[model samples]
Target: MTRTRGWLAAVVDIVLIVAFALIGRSSHAEAASPIGLWTTAYPFLAGWAVGWLVVRGWARPMRLWPTGVVVWVATVAIGMLLRVLTGQGDVAGDPLPLSFVIVATISLAVFLLGWRAVVRLVAARSGRRGRGRV
Candidate 1:
């Protein structure tokens, strides 16, 4: 495996992550311009970075337990925290809704961790069969 792949794993993460925001926006018929999407994405992106720092994610970016799980949790937890600051889903005086919190937590976990788990599974199978056996 190339060091570039390992080193740029976070970039892959960033793309997949931003996809969540863009998809949600499209679903709601919101403008999907780059600036608009970036605004929506920044909070989660910051949370993602925080997650990387918390896990020292580079050391084991592909591992499923602490790294992937921690990153997923941190992304949703901190992303929701930042969302309260952004005033997007607030209703009345409440900055964050219970349903939003629950949805964000579950969805982010699935999206952020799911692919890593799949890749690990595929890699394990491929390795067991010797490379290029696909």
Candidate 2:
């Protein structure tokens, strides 16, 4: 159940990130390319995998937020580097503002952290109350 929940959280986070990117793109006139598409999608998938592995598999709440932050930051940096290496396009396209990056990072971090917190809190409370009865 925990594993399933963690994966669900990750999928939700991916959706949220994509939504943010679309919202940011609404203000722009040009259509984003396929190269840009992968740039946005891959990072969230990577972050999602890491979040699930660390939080659900290991049952470690302490690692959730910090690891998420690290993964998101690194993902962004690596993405920029990849775009630069390929020279396919500018790292910061018109749609992806600095503000958008910050918001996306926060969104991913919060979703990952909040899910773990809720799961642990519920389990802890249940355990405590259950112990009293048994």
Candidate 3:
């Protein structure tokens, strides 16, 4: 991928993470203000950054293997760990509920990996078309 595409992929990932936070907040009837969204998003965003570094994702930003899967796992794991450490919870005593964890795991996987899958499919089709043309 070109540098521009790599950066764009990173931005897309960040936007999706923020979207996840927004949806969660809205569903819970929590505040939808910027500050509220930031509070919910920062942990996951931090995790994403870590994942990018760990995988050097810029080298292959669109790959669904180590890049997408590792980033997805890191985002959820680190995000939840941070939330627990910071005492953020759905209920008074449960900092990380099993139901919420499951939902988050599935939601983020779809959000993060789903886009890459679509991009790969489109690129594959375009490549085939280009080859047939020349």
Candidate topping lDDT:
3
lDDT at position 105, candidate 2:
60
Where in model 1 is the C-alpha error above 4 Å?
131-134
Candidate number achieving the greatest TM-score relative to the actual structure:
3
lDDT order of candidates, best first? 3, 1, 2
For model 1, residues 23-134, the per-residue Cα lDDT tens digits are: 8788879899999899878888999999988998888888778988988888887888888888876778889889767867777878878878888999899798896665
Q: Tens digits of per-residue lDDT for model 3 on 1-134?
A: 37888899899999999999999999999999999999999999999999999998888999999999999999999999999888887586777899999999999999999999999999999999999995
Best of the two (2, 3) by TM-score:
3
* Model 2 vs. true fold: TM: 0.51
TM-score of 3: 0.96
- Report the Cα lDDT for candidate 2: 0.54
Where is model 2 more than 4 Å wrong at Cα?
1-39, 47-96
- Write the residue-wise lDDT of candidate 2 on 6-103 in tens digits: 45555555675565445545545435665555555555555545644544433432344564455455545554444345443344554345665576
C-alpha RMSD (angstroms) for model 1: 2.7
- What shift in Å separates residue 107 of candidate 2 from its native position after superposition? 0.7
Report clash pairs, candidate 2: none
Which residues of candidate 3, in runs, are more than 4 Å off? none
Worst 10 residues of 2 by lDDT: 54-63
| Count of steric clashes across candidates, in order | 0, 0, 0
Question: In candidate 3, how many Å is residue 13 off?
Answer: 0.1
At residue 41, give the lDDT of candidate 3.
95
